[model samples]
Structures are given as structure tokens and as C-alpha cells.
Target chain A: MSAALPPFPKPQEALDAPELLQVGSGAEVDEPCLRADAARNRARLLDAAGRLAAEHGAAALTMEGVAAAASVGKGTVFRRFGDRTGLLAALLDHSERKFQAAILSGPPPLGPGAPPVERLRAFGCALLRRSIDELDLLLAGEPSAERRHTFPPRRFLRSHVALLLREAVPDADTELLSHTLMAYLDAALLHHLTEQCGLPPERVRAGWLDLVARVTRTDPPA
Target chain B: MSAALPPFPKPQEALDAPELLQVGSGAEVDEPCLRADAARNRARLLDAAGRLAAEHGAAALTMEGVAAAASVGKGTVFRRFGDRTGLLAALLDHSERKFQAAILSGPPPLGPGAPPVERLRAFGCALLRRSIDELDLLLAGEPSAERRHTFPPRRFLRSHVALLLREAVPDADTELLSHTLMAYLDAALLHHLTEQCGLPPERVRAGWLDLVARVTRTDPPA
Candidate 1:
């Protein structure tokens, strides 16, 4: 899962899995490995992206600057990510994966092995915390129509939440309820809290936990 | 009390009332004093909006076409509402007032004086029914932000819901839980169910009621 490929795969595979790596012990491997120069160029492109994101914000990143930083042709950068939108999505995916790992296995409360209700509360807080920390990354990963409509991460999060709620609350409508909870923590909600309401990220997380604890408990406080 | 004017002597006075609206004589004065021609134009605009929404979908409502259909200048349309975005918001507000009336005073289950749990279920169904019926209006009115934040209708609905939950499920964290319910009925979720999941709107409503009933009731079915 953590290997790099020598060349970009076919367009179909590229569309399906943006993160592709080629690794094997086959003599018939006609593709040359990533040259040291090519690897350096890739690293430079990524670094330039991070710097731009940090300084000017994600909305400021440009393909032209990325090409200049990587010392590559504009065509090369385009060929790699298709467009600025694609590059931004790929960058967002990196942070999203790390976030997924943290909730799935990294720590208590948010990770596995907590009381179901507490875990649900922790997951909401963790997600809210991440939204605050990676506002730039999230902004860059502009949710296109397709990503918002049909995506694995969105579905996975809902299913995970549904499972947790089913165990903790044991109501028949866990699936839809879980979906609602996921929507509550979605980009639109976060944007409203952070931008419109001018609420601090920590306060949002506190509200999330409060909601979660109340919803999941056997008998919520009056 | 049922007059068009506010309960207070003036609209500004109503702003300071304990409850949001006191439903007083001021409502009569606040009524739109549209000329016959202007009233005709307003109807045309709303009718065009509905037709365009029905045929081309919500994403298709543009300023130019709406203005042309209403036989008004683009500037007039902009003056009526600030922009295309504002026009959409106004359209939604129109529909929302009708919905608010229905839930607050129109009928059983949804109207006042029903069992709290039943009322809660009815409210969710009413909201879902309204969403499917007016999806374009809702989607168009969505504030252009990166995260989901509470809109006025959403907040009103949450407050109504919190009040009911406090009565029926008094032991639960009703305030946050109400938010969770509102989040589920968000435009995004409805689109997912109707467009992506291929579920009929009626089924979604039934599922919503079933889920709410299960959680609201104390004794579990064998």
C-alpha cells in the first residue's frame, strides 16, 4: 500500500484508484523504475503545494507555480494530475487517509475499544477537530458533484456510524440516523459554524460531543 | 391574533417579544402592498421558478431566464432580491412560511396538541415531504459555504423539535438530538435518497417515521 510506481497506469485505473504503485519481482517488468531525478521532481511538486497551501491558502495554488517549482513542463504537471482540481483532490486524500487511520486505530475514544456512545461522541469531536486543523486541505479538496454524490469515504463513514449507533442506541432507524449524524458533521455544517456563526473549532467539538452523548445514552438527561 | 401585522404595534417591537412572533395587528401593515401589475409580476416569477425547477431542475434557475419569463428587466429582478442567490433564498422562504403554518397550526400529528412522539415523527415526515416537493428551492437556498451551518428554517425546525423531544423523550439530550434530526433531512441527504439511492420519497418518509417511533417509545417490540 505504501509503494510508488514507475509510471502512471492506464487512464481507467487512474480514474478508479488515484493512489497506484507498481511493485513486483517479475523479470518481464518492461517499465523502468522512477529515476532519482523524477522522484526529486515529484517531491518538489508536493513541497511547493504544501507551502502554497500554508501561505496563500488552497485557493491560491496554481499549476504554473507547481510546474516551476518542480522544474517540469506545464504539460508534465497537467499529465500527472489532469488539472489543478485533480491535484487538490489528491492532496486532500492524503490528509483524509490520515484522519481515517486515527479514528479507526490510533487512539482511545475516537479509535476502537471505547464504550459505543463515548466512541461516537469522540468520533464526532475528532472529525470536528480535524476540520479545524486542516481547513486549508479541506478547502482545496473542493467536493465536486461526483465526489459529493458517490464516494467511498462518505459511505464508509455513514456505515461506521450506523454500526456504532446500533450497538449503543439499538434503534431500528440507526442507518438513517447515522447518515444524519454524518451530514451534521459535513462540510456545509462545519462551514456554517466556523464562518457564519464565528464559533471556535473547540466549541464546535464540544457541541458535537454533547449531542452525541445525549443521543447515545440509554437515558439522556432532561 | 391572526392578523397580518405583528402582535406588537410595529415589526421592530415584535423583535423583542419573548417568543419570536406574537401574531398581532402589525402583521396587517407588514403585508405586501403590491400593485395589481406588481402582484402579477411576482406570481409570474414564482410560477416560472417552479416550472423551471420542474423541467430543468433547481440548478437551472438563472437570473436572465427568470427575468425574461417574468417579462421584467434583469435589474428589476435583482432589485426584487439582491441576486440570483437571493432570489432563490426568497423562493425558499415563501415555501418555508407555508410549511411553518402547516406544522404549527394546520393539522393533527404535525399541528399542535398531538402526542409528542407522534408529532415528532409527523414533523420529520412533513419536512421530508416538503423537501422532495421543493428540492430545487431548498438546494438553491443553501448558503454557499464549505461546511453545513444552520439556516433559519433549520434552526426553527430544530427548536420545534427540541421542544417536542423535551416532552416525549425528556431524559435524552433533546437540543443536540434535534440538530441530528435536522441534519438527516438536509438537502444533501434527500438528494442521496431520491437521486442516488433510488428510494421513493414516500418510502423515505415512512422509514423516517419508523425510526423516530422506535427511539421515542420506551418499550421495545418483541
Candidate 2:
């Protein structure tokens, strides 16, 4: 049965993007249109809300809490983000942009300097940490099954993993492998492992490293 | 960072079930209470419904279509399965039982008497084919992300994979690896890969074999 299947494509050709990858974090695509100080104020509110969510939980993140945390009027927050749902979406978008920046251009390992395998390791670890911090918010924003793969942030992240896999294991099916790797870092899976199954985050992180090693056929970093 | 993490438990300990694995296919647990004739009649209705779904797709499946197909009254179909939702769920349940039987005791490679690695490969291939045939129905019945990992049918399936991985790779974290393997065979991922991405089912099947070989550190069968 396997012998009858078509030959696998070269990793580079198979994983090549036909169009430019959509790197824009959703909701932040409109950032430049805001007046400079308005953008700053929005950033400030999101930052305050992010801290509150991180310190307490996403359920604790209210428009009023964000207003008080940022020392802006509650009306300012309402005007900026409409309501609690809008505020949560903006908070997620804010964190996603920061995460993307770290991977796209921050320091080594997670950024550009490290080797592909090492970068892959750092990427999952960072994502695991970020997901743990924002599991509730991430779960709340999960796209429907139909849209799950097509969602822009998810596509961008998966594309990043695919790109790294192409560099790390150029002879393999990195396109599919990337999805498998990304599945390990999925927010819902993280929630189940941590909150439901009661596995420690460190154990899950170690599993990620082990998975990256196995998938790429590389030795774990010493 | 990895050293600070606690050691992974032996595969046996980690994968051990505290309770007997719930082998019951949901909706079928109530089977014994019905009179034998009523049960036979229900099976006949489900069989008709399943054939209609397979031939014309799940959306084309209706109470009237099932009744006509089975040469029974529409009221009988309605009474047996309640409505279209009930009918669809029963159709899926019927297929799940057949699939479980195949894996549990039906034949070699897929059933018994095959090497663990071979069984794992055949298990995925069988699932991929089943998923393709029932893609529409599976996507429609997808559990919410919170419940996805906990859904009884899903847990039963995942436990099977985890058990196989334990045999195939005793030193690895088979519990975590099982989730990684199961994610590949996920209905949503299958839908996205085949329908949305236009990959043929054979390509997806080949990918599954490749994944099994990589995760188990074995060569694909010659």
C-alpha cells in the first residue's frame, strides 16, 4: 500500500508559501490608523489589563479593572474597547503581537541568531509558558473547528514552525511535522494537561523538547 | 532547564489507567434494556441510516430517506432515533463500535497478533479512511475544546493509542506522545488537510505512516 503512494516532495518545495505569509496579528492590523497618543493609550490599557490577567486571571480582567489599573477613566476603557469581550480580545492581540515580535526579531534562540533546532526548542518553550499564563484567554478565543487551522494567528505561528522545520530537517515532511509539533503547544491541550490532568508545566515543557528532538532527529542541547 | 524538570515516569506507570478504560461506545450503553426485537429493529434503522450516509453523505441523510431506504415507516425511523440529530449521533456511534471491534479483535495489524509498531501504523490508516468517509459527520459532532480531550469516545481512542505507544516505545513519555499521534488523526485536521488544502487521502495516509515511523524510531515497512 505504501509503495503505491506518490513520492514525497522535497522539504523546501513542499513547504514553500505561494503568497507572503500573513504575519499581521489580527486586531493590531488597524494600529497605525489610530492617532499616535491614542495608540499609546490603547497600549497602556492593554498592558495594565494583561498584568491584571497574569496576576489574577483572565476572568478577573474587567474593563473597570483595566481602567483603574491604567489610571484612566472607566469611560476611557469602555470607549477604547467597547466591553469585556472586546477588552479580552484586545488583551490577547496585544500579547500575540509581543510574542510575534520576540520570535521575529528579539534576541537569540527565540529570535534569529540560534540554529533552527535550537530555535524550535525555544519557540515551544516560550509558547508553553505564554499559553500557561494566558490559558483562559486563549481558550476563550479559540476558533471554531472549521476556522481553527485557517485562523490568521494560528497560521502565522504554524508557518513559523514549518519554516524552522524545513531548515532543521530538510529531507523530511516538515509541513506535516510542524503541525504535529504545534499540536504539542496547543492552548487547549495545555489546559487539559495542566488543569485537568494535573501534569506540571515543566513536564509538558520537557515533553516539547523531547518531541522536537524526536521529530527533527536531533540530540537535545547539552 | 531540562535537568531541573523531574524525570519522566516509566511508560507503564505513566500510562496505567486508574480505572478500567471506558470501552463503552456512548449511546450503546443503554442497549441491554430494550427488548431483543426492539434492539434488532433499532439496529436495522441505524444500518439503513449508515448506508444512506455513506452513499449520499450525512447531510443527505434524513428520517424520510432512512425510512424509505429501510422499507420502514418514517414514524418508525423517527421513533427509533428521535430526529436527525439523534439519527446522526447513532450513525456515528454504530461506526465507532464497528471500528472498536476491528481494533479490539477483528483482524491482524489492525486487531491483534501484529507487532505494536505495525498495529499502530494500521490503526492510523484505518482511522484515516473512516474519517474521510465520515468527515462531514465527524466535523459536525466535534466536541468543544474544553471537552475535546475528555470526550468519552475520544478518551477511549486515545487510551488505545497510548497503550500501543507504550508497547512500541517503552522508554518514552507515551502518554504525551499518544496525544501527539492522535492529533494527527483528528477529524478537524483531516478536514482541513483534505477538503481545505486539497491533499488526497493517500497523501494523508502516507503522512501518517511517516509520523508513526518517526515517533517510534522505526523504519516504515518494506
Candidate 3:
């Protein structure tokens, strides 16, 4: 069975920022006088979380370890992040924000304003590259325990890709086609490419570009 | 980590003959020919096994239940199928052979003989159909713990698609591209369509056809 989406009570909170922390916290934290030391502590905690996730698995990450690494008290870490899963969710949000930026505005190919088809190819290629780069982070975000009914980044990514496909193909079922494309671009496929098939990154990107071009081209099926 | 494939082994004698029984003098008697009673017993055993598997799932199937359902001794069930795993394997084999035929020689589009693109489209449609019709059987055969190094059916299926792609896009790295396409058709994707996304079977098929046709059309990258 497919894993259920994460069940955040207010799903919109996860979808939109400025309200992200409000799902559980009830109100937005709009305090303007945040101390410099508080921001430093927050940065240190997030940094420690990333290092731990990269060095060990997400499952291995512990609040105690994070607190020790950040040189913060255990109570402060818990007060800031709640629990392990909560911390993991925050980590996912942090990574997704960075990934979203790359896709939306980072540079040529992956960024906006390029031809729809080329940009789509770049998106797939860049996603594969990022998957390879942040495997542990991606793996950690996987839905387990069947608790929530939230949208996955992959879902949003697929939807965005589908929007691009509408421009490329213009005639196909955009949503379903997007799902099909995302299915292929899954972490499993990326893992198989680099880990199982031993294909190099440039070669994988080239192959992806060819597939996108072939599929999105105006030529009728032979 | 990916599931390990099982090593292939020779078929056991118990599954080879369904109607044979040991006589008092250790002679193997063709029970279906000599004892009408023995033939009925064999049929009963198979029916019971099927029911149990359908009811409790393939994993939950037990020889003990088969014996009770068939009104046969525990030893007789073991004598017929060797063990629960063997029985499950045999059941899976029966269905797999039929599926292989459908893809390999059963019809146009899906079978060998159609134009490569049509064949590829048919292949995906057939696979997605099978994923819905035989989810359990498909799940059982994968990540099999035999022929461990062999690519999955999806991989092989994609390889076949890649061959077609090579014909259309000779310079592209179609091999890896095929892997990506196969992943798109994975059971998980099918589950998402039918179970999670709540789309009908035809919708998924149409999407696949459109995807394959569009992706493989002979167009240069934009």
C-alpha cells in the first residue's frame, strides 16, 4: 500500500510559510526584538541537526546529541523543537525551502525564464543531482507510521513539472503525466542509477535530458 | 536498501505431482488413477491453500491451516507442497508464467511484432493493468531474496523500451532512460493511481500511453 500523507491538522500551514510554525504553536511568531544570541543558538541547532543527519542516519539523530553538538541545554533543544519527529519535520522543511529556491530561481536551466521543455529537463537533472547529494535528508523525509495526510514535496514537484509539461505537450493529461514523470524521477530510480547501475552524474543528466526531449517533442508517435 | 533477490533452486518433487501417494510398500501410486479418494484430497488441498492465501494474505498462509481446511493430515499437506514458502512460490510461479505470456506473445501492441513505440506503450499499459489485477503476485516476485543480479521485470521492461528508444534516438543514453521509465510504472505508482489518487484504471493507462508516445517521439531536445 502507498504511504499516507502526513496529517498536519492545518495542511495549509505546511504549504505556506509565515504560518508554518503556527499549526502547533497557534499564533505566528512575529516578535521584532529577537535577541542576536537567540538567532545564533537557532542557527547552531539547525547546523548541528544537518551534520548529525549527514554523518549518521536521520533515525540515529537524537535531541541529546544535537544539544551537545550545539552546546545548548537539553531543555532548550526540546523547548525549541519538541521531539525527534518534530525536529525531523523541521529539517525537511528547511531542506525543501532550499530545494524549492533552486528550482524556482537559482540559475540557468533550473531557474525560471528558460524554455519550458529545457527547464523541465534541467529540473529533472537537478533533482537527480540533489537526490544524490542529499540522500540522507531525502530518505529521512519518507513517510512512515501512516499518521498524516499531508502533501509530499514530490507531489508538489510533480505538480510543478506537470505545469511545465502542459506547455511542452499541450495536449496530454497534465496531472496524470506529471505523476508518471515523478514516478520515474523517484529516489529509488536515482539510487538505482548511481548506486546500482554505476552511471556517472553527467551521463545520467544527459540521459534524462534526452528522455524529456523525446517525450516532450511535437513529433507524433512513430 | 533494495531487497535482495532469492537464489533460484530446483523444483521439489512434492509440487511436481499432485495426485501421487505413498503406498504401504513404499511404492508411489498415482492416486488420481488408482484411488478416487486421493485425487479429491489433492484438489481439496489446493483449494484450501488458495482460500487461506486470499483470506490471510500470502505471508500469513500456513500449512497447518491448509491441512485443517482440506481435512487432510498435516503430513499430507507437507508431502504435497513441502512448506508454506514453497507453496507460495509455486502459486506465484503459476501467475508469473501467464503474465510473461501476455507480454511476450499474447497480443499485438503488448507482444513482440508491433512497432517499437506501440509495443512499448502496450507494454506499459499491460504492466499497469497487471499491477492492479495482481498486486499481491507482483509484490511477491519483486526484491525476491533467485537470480539476484538480474534486473527487475520493470528494468527488463524498460530495457525493451530502451531498445525501441535506441531506434528512435540513437545517440541518447536510452539504457538509463529506460530505467527511469520503468520506475514510473512501478507497483507503487500503480497503487498511487488506483488506491491513493483514486483514478480509474483507464486513466492511468491513457496517461502511460501519452507519456510513452510523447517521450519516444523522434524530436530533438528544445
Candidate 4:
């Protein structure tokens, strides 16, 4: 259906792209007030929160729970994060950096040691899994339509897909094809397919693999 | 960066779908109080508004202008549609129905006489043209996230595309592939590529044909 207004919410700042998600070491620059020990404490709390979210769900994570998990005062969590939104944002940034590092340098397939097609398959599957785990958290941070593509993390992921597609399908229009491929892995679309449409995560995963093959014009992996 | 949100605005009812767009008769059902001549007059006014919109972009549409163009009293325009929102919605529905009719029954390629691939190509080009014309109106009518895929008109178009895809690539999962194909023509994405990214409509149109070819694993048409 045609919308009366453009469907995307206009986003102001893009989500972090390449550099902003540089894992733990980079965040300290944004918080000059944190002395070394406090920074360590903050990292510890965040790590504990990550574990809590993984064990329960991102939706179940609470500042108090994180403190308890870290064996610190709830005040410590509050003093560090300010609010739930802040905590969740930081957690996402942490997770993004971790994920980025894993793909950028961690190992084969998702990293550098595999073929482009295999890498593309691994990337979508990995992204799908990460999205499913953090669906609620990711959904909340959605930007407006204008900024959706420019958002840093999304740009990074799409660029990665484009890179693989370039190698895999040298003759294809990988730029737009990248967007087509990334559209399948979009957080909102994935949420729609899995939660609203009642499609299973495995089915969604299979679909992504199928999509990669079609876009790359290759046979689907057996 | 990974979003804290899953990110789509969860829309409930899809923006008006197929039936909501029945040119004029269906709207009468919503207003049983109007007399025959009054209904005819109202439709006439809408027709004038549609002409005005096409001539001067939907963004330029105004009640005063619509009245002047329709050669009716400004009061009549206000009375008929109540507000700009109502009028635009009516206009969108009116336009949607006209478009639906053409594709469902009009002529070869776009209608039914040509092969499915040709029809598919015509369908995208025609949609791209319609979108370019009503970009603002359609965007304004964007549905909430939950209702987006389920939105009736979009579903109608996607089902149409899926039908073609099934014939074009019977082995593919046309259901998901249809979504993939539709994503290429998504209003938001089009707005981004054309307006934000500054890609011309022809470029986008080209991309769609290429995408269709790649998905069907066929060479681009001559």
C-alpha cells in the first residue's frame, strides 16, 4: 500500500558504523570521569549484564539484576548506566563491537579464512542468530527511515555483504544487490517474519541462505 | 551499530488495502446519508483533486486549489473530505484502485496478454512510475511495522509478484522471494535511493529489472 508520508522514521544520528563499535577500549574516551578501577568495574558490570541477557533475554535484563550478577551494588549499575535505555545502548554497542571484531578478525568463514559464498552464508546466519537473541533490544533502537541505511552498524554489515557479493558475483550489481540481501536480514523484517508471521528462526535462516544463492546466482549449499 | 530497537514502528491495520481503494462506489458504503447527485458530486470533486495532484505534486495539493480546480465552492471541498488527511487518503485509495484495475484487467504485459516475465517487468516499471508520482501520499500512508507485510494492498502486489516468480523460478521460495523482490520497490528504500542517495528513477528501474533477472537466473532483456 502507498503511504501518505514516507514510511521510514527520519533518523538524526546514524547508529555506529565502523569505528564507533571498537569494543571495550574505545568507550572510555567518552567517559573521562571514569578512573581505571571504575572503568574496570563498569566493564565487569556490562559483562555480567551480557551474561544475564544471554541467560534470560535482553528483555529480561534489569540494572539491578546486572548488579547482582556482577556482585556490585545496584547503585553501581545506576551510577554507571544512568537508566535502562543507557544500559541497553551500551550493551548493544558492546555486542556490536564484539561481533564486529569476530567478523573483522576472529577467524575463518565470517572473518577471512573462507570463500566469499561461504562467508556470505556464515555472515547471514550469524547475523540472524545475533538478531534473534537481541531482537527486543535491537527493535527499540530503530531509527527513522532516512537514517536506516546510513546507520553505522547496518552500513558496516551491508558493506561486508557487498564485499562478499563482489567476490562471489563479480558481474552482478552488488551495490543494490547488497541492499537486497541486507533487507532480508533487517531487524524489523526478521521480527515480522519470525514473531508476527510465526515463521521459525530456522526457516528464516534457510531463507537467507536461499536468498544469498539467488542473488549470487549460485547453487544453494546442500 | 546494532539497534537497541528491533526498529519498525509496529503498525496494526495495514494502510487501506484493495477494497478500501475501490474508486468511488466503495466509499459510498461508508457514507449512506449522501444523496445520489451528492455522491456523484463528491466523486467529481475527488476526480478534480486527483487531476490537481497529478498536475501539481501531492505536496502542492491544497483545499482552496482543489475547490478552484474543481470549480466548486471551497466549502464544498471541505464538507466532502473534511480535512486534507481525509482527502489525501481518499485520493490514495482512488489512485490505488485505478492502478489495481489496470494491472488486474487492463491490457497486455501490465494486464495479462504478455508472458509473466514481461508482465513482471511492466509491473515494476509501472509501480515505479506510480510511486514517483504519489511518493509523498504513499509515504504518509505507511503502515505500522506489524501491519506492513500484512498490509492488504502491498500483500496484493506481493502476491501478484509471487505468482510470476513461481512461474519464473518454480524451485525458489517465491513467498520470501516475493518479499525480496518487493523490497527492491519499497517506497522507503526508493525514497532513500532517489532522494537521499540521489539515484535517478531510471537507475532504480534498471536495478529492479536486473534484480528480477538475477532472481530468475536469466539474462537481462534486450
Q: Is model 3 an incorrect, acceptable, medium or high docking prediction?
A: incorrect
What TM-score would each prediction reach against the true structure? 0.65, 0.92, 0.67, 0.81
- Going through the candidates in order, the fraction of native interface contacts each one reproduces equals 0.26, 0.43, 0.28, 0.28
Ranking of models by TM-score: 2, 4, 3, 1
Candidate 2 residue spans exceeding 4 A from truth: A3-26, B3-5, B8-26
Best by TM-score: 2
Superposed by TM-score, candidate 2 places the C-alpha of residue B118 at a distance from the truth, in angstroms, of 0.6
**Which model scores highest in lDDT?**
2
Task: Assess candidate 3 and give its lDDT.
Answer: 0.59
Which tens-of-lDDT digit does each residue in B1-222 have in candidate 2? 562336665543454452233533355667879999989888888888878888888878889999998888899987777788888888888888788888888889899899999999999999999999998888878878888888767777888888899899998888889999999999888888888777778888878888888898887777
Task: For each candidate, report its DockQ versus the true two-chain complex.
Answer: 0.17, 0.50, 0.18, 0.21
lDDT of 1 by residue, A93-122 (tens): 555666677767778777788878777877
Interface root-mean-square deviation, each candidate: 15.6, 3.0, 13.2, 10.5
- TM match of model 1 to true structure: 0.65
What tens-digit string does per-residue lDDT give for candidate 4 at A102-211? 88897988888899999998899899999888887787777666567767777778778877887898766566788899888877787877887666677677778878
Docking class of 4: incorrect
**Where's the lowest-lDDT run of ten residues in candidate 3 chain A?**
A19-28
Prediction 2 TM-score vs. true: 0.92
Chain B superposition TM-score per model: 0.74, 0.89, 0.60, 0.81
